[model samples]
Target: MEKTWWKESVVYQVYPRSFMDSNGDGIGDLKGILLKLDYLQELGVDVIWLSPVYKSPNDDNGYDISDYQSIMTEFGTMDDFNRLLSAVHERGMKIMMDLVVNHTSDEHPWFLASRSSVDDPKRDYYIWRPGKDGKEPNNWESVFKGSAWKYDEGTDEYYLHLFSQKQPDLNWENPQLREEIYSMMKWWLDKGVDGFRMDVINFLSKDQRYMDGNILDGKQHGDGSPYFLNGPRIHEFLQEVNQRVLSDYDVMTVGEMPGVSPDDAVLYTGEDRGELHMVFQFEHMDIGGGPEGKWNNEKWDLSDLKGILSKWQYRLEEVGWNSLYWNNHDQPRVVSRFGDDGEYRVESAKMLAACLHMLKGTPYIYQGEELGMTNIAFESIEEYRDIETMNSYEELVNTYGWPKEKMMAAIHARSRDNARTPMQWNDGRNAGFTTGTPWIGVNANYPEINAEKAYNDHQSIFHFYKKLIQLRKQHDIIVYGRFDLLCPDDEQIFAYTRTLGEEKVLVLCNFKGQEATLTIPTELHSLKATLLIGNYEQEESDTVSSEPLRPYECRVYLLK
Candidate 1:
């Protein structure tokens, strides 16, 4: 495997909207991020991945960019953004910004011009076609569960949008558009930002034929796969993107590749791929999909989750690298999603951290993952602000006319709203996120889940995360070490070892909320090991005789 800084370091993602609010505007801003540098330094994260803070209409919660070079007014000015870059670099940490080029907001100048007239020079900048018999041009479905084409009366054409109608898909086939994106990327690279986390990068290219998708349940009948995800000429576009911009800098590039498979992951991030440093595959993250990408309360067994995770880990170890994540701004927090947040909140959080961090990959700790945050409970759908969730609910209730109760149940289980809540800074009003009303509601339990409370508690999830990152840095075995799964037969237990030269580190965890035991494999049984860091201190008996792990107990042992 190639030796890159990203291959050995841990990254933490911070949703700027929830990280902190400096101006009391109920929005997290760049100034608020500057104030939290010390806190991040304490957590020992090497990279702070900021979600898009670009000038936007915020139709997709800031993913819809109106201007590429400017910062959103709600986020502060470009000057504040530069100051944030300085603050992060000064603290010996790298900063990564979102690269959301799959589409731009309809309000963007490019889109506005494209929609002006059919024969306009900029009309081809976006995908637009004359309506078919006065209707949508193509039978494609939007990812949010509706028609992908929207009629523009003035232009006498329908534009394609894989997401919200306000966020029109960018035509990557245009060489000028490609150059512009690359130029903007180089500008950021020159500005000293460390890297980029691309949004839906696989969807950048689409089939030129505009073929129809397969009809499923009377929805738009077209091959959505061809129209979107890993479309024709995607790698060519990405390789060009890399050569002109990404390859010029030694920064990490993690693409949010939703439709990529394990084999495709190799192609996207392999040593010879020359495309991306890493890419996120939703195999593990998409365990429970509601009706058309929604979240549901469907029971997910631990074994299935472990198997999916192991498949990616083992496959990437041989092909490319994996971007390990338990939470992000688009998904619910890890602790609340996988671990028991009610009774074993702290222990389960720390245990889950230890379990995943020891694996051979670049672990990404989303903001508040270190504090073991739980899901938010919104009072009504009207209170939600995320465009994706709102559109989905509308599709179910308005277009399809599904039962409202059924939709609400799914929303509770899977809404992006769970992750979009403001950061819980303290038990103070508005969770100390903002002095004014928050753009989104705060998790009501913020008082108990704030950073202050966790930072002070020695056994808090925050401190455990610190130890986890430091261990990866201090020990070579944890970084480039080869991974081997042990005792794979045990459904409730997940265990693995990393072997670097002669150094060996073993990690064992009880994923479920019940105590479980697994016999040490022969290779590990005879090895003399010392407890390095654990969620709980080892009892005399546990040290003297390797005992079975209790519920949510995770420990790492270094070979002596």
Candidate 2:
């Protein structure tokens, strides 16, 4: 396999609003991130994927950007951002800024002009269509709920918004708009920023002929994703972006692409494609969901999870690279979703980390993940802050007439707010995140799962993660090794091997709370195996045994 800086480096994602608060204004800011540079450096991450910090109206917590070049006032001024950038580079770490060009806040100047009138100069900058038979242009559903098209009374037309109504989709077909986006990207690169984490980049190129989608769940609108996601000319636009701006810089770019397949991923991230370094696909995240979508409560199958991950690892091995991650700002904590978040929280968290980090890809660690943070169970719907969750609740309860208890159960399991809670810095007030009241309520378990406690404990999840990061740096096989799944059908164990040249390593992880036995295959039973690292205390053994492994145990064995 080819070698690259991003390929061998570990990327840490920081949701700025939940990381830390310096001035006690109840929100995390650039200054607060500047204060935690040492913390990140000590954790041994090479690249920091900072979530959107651009100027916004806070309609979607900074995703709905209003200004491309300016920093949000809540996050601090442009000078503060410059200082943060300098500090990060000084510490020998790169920063990947969130690029949210697929859509912009309605408050943005371009969108403001586009929505003014039909003959406005910037009217074509956004996707606008006339109503169809006194209804919306098409029966498309917004990701957050309701109609995707919002009627603009001023222009007597409808504007497309895949997300919240406040976010208007940009017209990628317009060369002028594309140029503006490229100019903004160049400005940041020239200002010493590393690269970008393109948000919903696949949604940029949409099908020109708007059409109604097949209705699902008996809703008034249907999922219009098929007409927009990975639409025609996506590659052309991305290649243009690479040629005009990205190719000129020595930076990394990872596109957040939902509903992308493995074959299509190759075209996006292939070494010679010049589109992206890698893409974050959501197939793994949607493992346990049913036909009703993410909110449906369905039991996750370990075998299915293993199959999806293994398929991606193998398919992308030669052509493209993978961006391995379990938790992000948009998803629930991995420990809570897939592992035992109660009794075996620490053990399962380590196991999940080991399983992901040992894969043949670049690993991303979200904020608060190292401390084994679990999902929060808000008692009341009013306590939820995420627009997606709140909107879903209203629709499910009021429109669908679903029981409040059922909706609340789904909200507790799938809400983005589960991951947006304040970072547990210490056991003090507000989990030591801020002196003032937090924008969202802190998890009630923060007293037991805060970073301070983990840092003080030698055997805490934080230290285990530190060791994993160190091991990745020490062993090149972990980065570029060829992956092979051992037991593809095991329901309680996830086992795989990484081979690079003559070096070979086997990783075994127990996914459940009960002890499971994994017998060594006769093909390699005679090989000497040295325990490299594990979650539990165990002496280095030079031979493979048939003994049963402990619950949630993770072991890495180097074979000779």
Candidate 3:
């Protein structure tokens, strides 16, 4: 495998709207981030993956971009961004901006011009089609809810929007539009920004057939993913992107591709392919989701998760690279979803961190994750601010006749707002995220699971992550080692090993609340082992024992 700065570095994702409030306006801003640079530096993260701070209408929490060049008013001005970027670089850390070019806000100047008339030159910049038989252009439904096509009275046509109606999909087929995107990318790179985390990048190229998707049981809209996801011309568009803009700068790129398989990933991230450095695949994230989609209370099996993760690790080992993450701004907290968030919140959080960080890829830590922040079960649906969550609740309860309590349970389990809650800095009011009201309600458990409590205590999850970050920096084997799965059928124990030349490191985690025995393999019983890190403290002699791991306990060992 080849080596690179991103491949060996750890990334920390910061959702600006919920990170910290600087002006007491109930919203987080860039100056709030500037104040926390020391905290990030102390956490030992190499890269800060800042979520979309571009100018927007907040329809999708900044995902719907109106201006690629200017900063969001809620996040501060251009000078604030420049200072934050320079301060990050001064601290020997890099920052990756969220690139949301797959779609633009309907209020964007380009979209405003595009919707003006049929013969408008900017009309080609967006995907527009005439209504079919007095209905929508196609039977596709938006990911949030309702028809994907929004009829515009001005143009006498409907426009495609994969997400909200306020977010119109861009036309990647137009050469002029592609040039405009490239020019915007150069504008940012010229400002000393590091790289980009492209949002839904694979959705850029559509099938162009505009065919109706298959509607599943009890669904109102068709599933149009097959027509738009990883389309035929995706590689061509990506190659053009790389050649025209990315190749000119030395920066890392990771595409947020939803339905990509391991084979498709190799094509996108392969060194010889000239597309991207890596991709955020959604196979593991889709585990608990059922045929009815993410609006259910289905339980995910452990063996299935192990299978999916191992497959990616093995498939991307030789050709492409992987971007390892358990949760992000769009997903719920990992401790609540995969591990015990009740009695073992701290233990499971550390275990989850170790499981991902020890893998053969770049690890990304979402903000508040280092403090073992769990999900919030808000009392009312009105308490949630996420557009996806709100739409899903209305559709499932009022439209589909789902029990209100059941849908709320699902919301508690899978809502993206679970991760968007304000960052808990201290046990004070509003979790110290703001002096005034927060945009969303803070998790009530912040009193026990805040950063201040974790930072002061030596045995907290925050320190455990700091040690994991430092270990990855010190050991070359952790970065380039080949992964080997052990005990694949185990229900409670998730174990694996990393081998590089003469060095071998073993990782073990108990995924459940009960104690599970982890037997040592006979092949390496005689080797001397030293404990690298473990959530629970035990004597050094116990490192080689077949003792039962207590309730989400995790341990890593370096064997000689």
Candidate 4:
């Protein structure tokens, strides 16, 4: 195993829209981010992974890019962005832009030109295919719930969109498109960006044959995802990308791969020869998405999640590096998802940080996650704004014949908007996100949970994260130590150990409400550490015993 610089660095993810608003236009902007440099410095992060701020039609938020070169006017001019880059570097933090080239807004110049006429020079820039049997080119369905191929009357062909129809898939098969994307990436690199977080990057290479999938049991389409996720020629395209732009820059790239397996991840992030530095895998996040399409139907036993993460941690440790994270712009707050938000919100939030940060991999912290934010509780469906959530909500009620109350329950459980709501800055009416009406409502608890409050509280989750980050940077073991599951078969205990030459850490977590004893392993007999951190009242002596641990108590014991 090689050294992981990312594991030693504290990464902060910025959802650009909700970060800051300088123009008073009720939206966050680059200038707004520039103004917050001091704030970020105070939080003590090594890198900031900014979400997309590219010129777009605002479909699927900013994930749909219309122009790669120009920054959205709403976000401020490119000059403002350049100043932000300089300012961030001045504060000793690197910047990583979100790369959304897997798909582009239909309004992108290439897509617009491609849609005008089939014979147009730019027609190959996007995936445009003639309808098969006068129907869609395949039995694939869009992630937004419709035929993947949309009829384009002007071109007399259908344009493929894995996500929204507004966002058409780019044809990676075309050398010209690949060259263009590489060029844009280099342009950002030249401007001094540290790296990129590729969005749904696995979605670029589609099944070459355009094969109609087998009809699902009582369902219309197969997980058409198989067609677009990690398709043929993906490695070739990634190698080309690395050779063209990434290889030349001292950059760190983390691909947002939704459906990739461990073997594929090895290819994408292996230490010996991989396309990216690391990748954000979806296995852990999907635990809450549930097996069915029902939004609020997410259910996970603590033991099951423990097994899932343990397997990934073990399997990927050998082949590739992992991008460790709990929350991002696309998912709900971590405390709400994995912890009992009502009773153990703050403690478990810090505990979750302790659990993940101790892993031998890179760790990413979403904006406000350090402050222990919880999920939003919207009163009406109209209050929701995310396109994905809105579409699913409407489907459950109007199209699928689900009761409104039942659908609302689902929406609360799995809606992406639960995470996309404006950042809650204060106790103001709009949560201080905007002086005027915000584009979306902030969680009402912002008053108590804002950064201001946390800055004052010494034992706040925010401060705990700051401490954990410092420890990760100073200690080599936390970064390179091999991991071992201490209690794999326990139904409620998620315990593990990270070992270096002579140092060791014992991490124990009791997931449920009842008190349970953690039977300390004999191998951990060398440790004589006091309780470094725990989610509950830790009853640790100078030396841990082979005693069962208490409930919801996650303790980290350092070697004395």
- Where is the poorest 10-residue window by lDDT in model 4? 288-297
lDDT per residue (tens digit) for residues 1-560 in model 4: 76645556889988878877766678888987887778788878899999998898898889899998889888988898889999999888999999998889999888878888878899999888888788888888678875778899887788888889898989999988888888889989998999999998888888888887766655565567767788888887888888888889888899999877777888988776748888888787887564345374667777777777777788787788888998998887888888767777776787788888888788899988888888887979899888888777766577767799887877776677777777766666566666766677778788788877787888888788888877777678778888898777787778898888877877877676667776676657756776666555545587764556554566777765
**Candidate 3: lDDT over CA atoms?**
0.93
lDDT of 2 by residue, 412-457 (tens): 8888999999999999999989999899999999999998899899
Off by over 4 Å in 3: none
Clashing pairs in 1: 212-222, 212-223, 213-222, 213-223, 214-222, 427-447
Candidate 2 at 383: error in angstroms? 0.5
The lDDT per prediction is: 0.85, 0.92, 0.93, 0.80
Which stretches in model 2 have alpha-carbon errors above 4 Å?
none
Better of 1 and 3 by lDDT: 3
Give residue 445's error in model 4 in angstroms: 1.2
Clashes of 3: 0
By how many angstroms RMSD does model 3 differ from the true structure?
0.9
Model 3, range 423-512, lDDT digits (tens) per residue? 999999999999999999999988998999999999999999999999999999999999999999999999999999987899998999
What is the TM-score of each predicted model, taking all chains together?
0.97, 0.99, 0.99, 0.96
In candidate 2, residue 464 scores what lDDT? 89
lDDT of 1 at 222: 61
Winner on lDDT between 2 and 4 is 2
